[model samples]
Target: MPFPSRPVAKPQLRAHSKYPSIPSPSATYLVPNTSDPVGASLGGVRVVNEGLVGIGRLSGENVDKFGETQGAASGLYITDWAYASGQFSGKFNVLPDRGYGDGSSNYAARLHEVNFTFTPYYGTSVVPQTQVQATYVDSTKFTYQDGATVKFTTGLNPDTVGGVVGARTGSLFGQTVGLATAANGPDGAQESLLSFDAESVHLFPDGSGYVSDEYGTYIARFDATKKITGLTQLPGAAQPNRPANTPNFDSFTAPTTGRRNNQGLEGMSVTPDGARLFALLQSATVQDTNGGQQQTRNHARLFVYDIAGANRENPVAVGEYIVRLPQIDLNSDGSGLDGTAAQSEIIALGPDSFLMLPRDGNGLGKGTTVPILFKSVQLVDFASASNILGQFDNVGQAVSPAGVLTPGVNAAATAEVINMLQQDDLAKFGMNTTIPANSNTLNEKIEGMALVPDLSTEQPNDFFLFVANDNDFQSSDVKMLNAAGQVVSRGDGRLNAGITNDAMYYVWRLTIDAGAKFFRMDVADAP
Candidate 1:
């Protein structure tokens, strides 16, 4: 059967150049003629390279109509220059047997989501189920892979997996998982997820690459069935070089707990050469000893992992740095106040560096009128990241009230990272120097980021940026940016428009190829 697809209308586009360029400059765009005067202005040149090339929503006709279609639209694998759209097929089995405690069904392991497309050079993509047990309640931390359909779910300490729904197997929890016949609900009552957390897969010419998490953990390898290739509990800058036995898993020392309660890693992006890895971390602590429960502790940090060294078993953190602002309070809920967890999702811009989108906190900015100024994507040097394993004895460093930048290899090169965070850099593209009005509306959780190839220009690095926003139809604001972090494009408003901003939730992964082909599978709104 044909998979479902959604078309975006008036698809928003912003930029800093007269046209989209490779390695987009650190700038903003001009404002469009819209209803709200204080709204974001658009700038530079707006270019729509390709439109509706592929679809990335869950199966089922009326699935969750509130999510943007998940799929790739730009990047290295440009399928056709002729502008012709591409197509592919996959399966999602509906499981009815799995049930949550509240008289509702869940789509955990019995039937995970499976979907994939091809890249110009790397034929068929192969992403099997990585984390089987993760798909339990409608609310667990399950990620979608080549064979899985649930999108990447991050944040929220006690993660839940309730939305995954698909084909059912007669076995679960080590028993023969079976499917039920009834549907469940609290909010996205259907659906399920794979076994992994935030993950990135590189489809090598031979389908062999490492699939690691933020904490530098290589959970599994991607072969035919997403095989259980290797595991390193003690993952870091070092290589353990241990052979995999049955149920193999590593046990590296966590950078947190060991230190001043300062290490919690998330967001892992590998270099093109696969020699280095970059990680983003969220550190939490109470600024004032007498504040309320959630207010007393919260901090966020960024670190780098150098794999080129010899000690594989104990890879040390070679670089470290802090991206903070005086008025930027991590402890405050959306209001930029005190005592909030300043969170961020990271992605690699190139081999030399990466970018971070730090969300101030979970506050709605309703009561207090604190401007949300911590939503910019700051660029940073990969080499300059201090070794968490080496420094502070692998016992992660504390991110104090004043965010710190513990220089790594190329501290001087931080200009690129800082420029992307500048208000002027964003203004060039006609974008608001501050956070957009409803910054947190669509979960504002940017999990995956990829650059779309635009060869017509002199620079090839300036590709398009596609962020994976998890809130399905509820907040269908899958942000599109130029290489420089400008709001150049927005999700298709068609399938996502008219729906209440809260109608859906969760957009997991965002993948792109040279052919302008893309894939973005959602764990919540699969219809």
Candidate 2:
């Protein structure tokens, strides 16, 4: 019983005083005011004009300097910005996990630097030639920060530092444990000590940052040179600890207690002041899920770390809270619950509040006919939530034993900020929430999110939230590469097929309440 599809309507183009003609592939829509349901739920925050103000895109078949296919971004961060000489220009970075190999071949984790200029149109009376223009800077493969490239392997290795071949260790970051094998690894692929599966990335003012991983559910710090500097491991409860003293990182095999395979830290953020770091799991850990039931993964964990001052290298877990993720209807019908909508990324508004994107696995790139139900950027507040740091940071401890929070434990407060499924908003972009989604439809996996100030003197509180997608390297005409940087064929042989999913980006303009204490850029030109 899927939801009925809405009638496809032509885009309503409007001219603005700033430009005589409307820009192609970009539009300025009405924002949601206090009276709107989404705005009302914000309590005090506001969304300027219908939410979305601009959109940009990158081709799926785009390749890097290494001649390897550039996959969709799993994370995003604005490294620098400026508003001088009557123009707005900025530089940012996008994180792409193990290349087109998925979990089979050994692909290196990398980052793509992009430079762009933005010509914002706040109202219908003001249009510009180009709403948002972006250009590729270059791509860099992550290293041990000691001259060694990190590989994305599914095989396991023993814990030993450098100088030993195949030793499971990082350069400056020493010995690693809980080595496990993924169920989908090739029959025989080389194992390496420098394995990684990058998900979310957050940068500090100095260009150093942390990238959350899916394999170890670990967060590794990187220097300005994009090299690994330090590592922060999660508590035992968040790791996949196998029974019989053996490692089992395979997604198909259930660990005695720990994170489910592939369901590791997907979203992470650091406070603007660089005093704290927040890491969120994609969903519930193995133990938190009621007997491996995916539907019960609604109870996810949010870990807060003290990374201020001396704690930068050795971050301490200060607080852990339960974030009840939303459950959606798998059938798209008004029926029983399906499963938890996995969260992809998060951004800190303050030490006590942040923005989270939780979405379903449907839409354009999924190759499914189901209609998308839920995909949104939500505001989460942990001001009054109970801290379960010490008590639940171990094996056998469950925050919600029966699919609900245990007594005395309080979950974080969440309010919808931007619902990507809104028919009116998607319509303006030539997108929709229809069954058997088309190329023009909204793509699945809106994972990356970054916030920047609007830099307007009159509206000091306004900001732009950039949302991006993870295309899964579904380009029909892209070359696949192996660990040795050699071109290879995809196992499925759909390389030159008809399927093509581009890396999509959507920009939403929002107005935050001054009292909310949202992070603001300190650039000289910033209002």
Candidate 1 contains a number of clashing pairs equal to: 136
17-95: candidate 1 lDDT, tens digit per residue: 2221232222211121111111111122112222111213322112212121222111111111111133221222111
Kindly list the per-residue Cα lDDT of model 2 for residues 149-218, writing each as its tens digit.
Answer: 4433322322323443222333336534433232212233444435567889987767777888877777
Candidate 1: lDDT of 313?
25
Model 1 regions lying over 4 Å from their true place: 1-196, 199-205, 208-221, 233-264, 284-303, 306-343, 361-374, 382-388, 394-443, 456-458, 472-527
**lDDT by candidate, in order shown:** 0.28, 0.67
Which runs in model 2 stand beyond 4 Å of their true positions?
1-37, 40-50, 84-87, 122-130, 145-191, 244-246, 483-485, 491-497, 514-518
TM-score of each model, in listed order: 0.44, 0.82
In the predicted model 2, the residue pairs found to clash are 16-125, 17-125, 30-49, 30-50, 31-48, 31-49, 31-50
Please give the lDDT score at residue 158 for candidate 2: 27
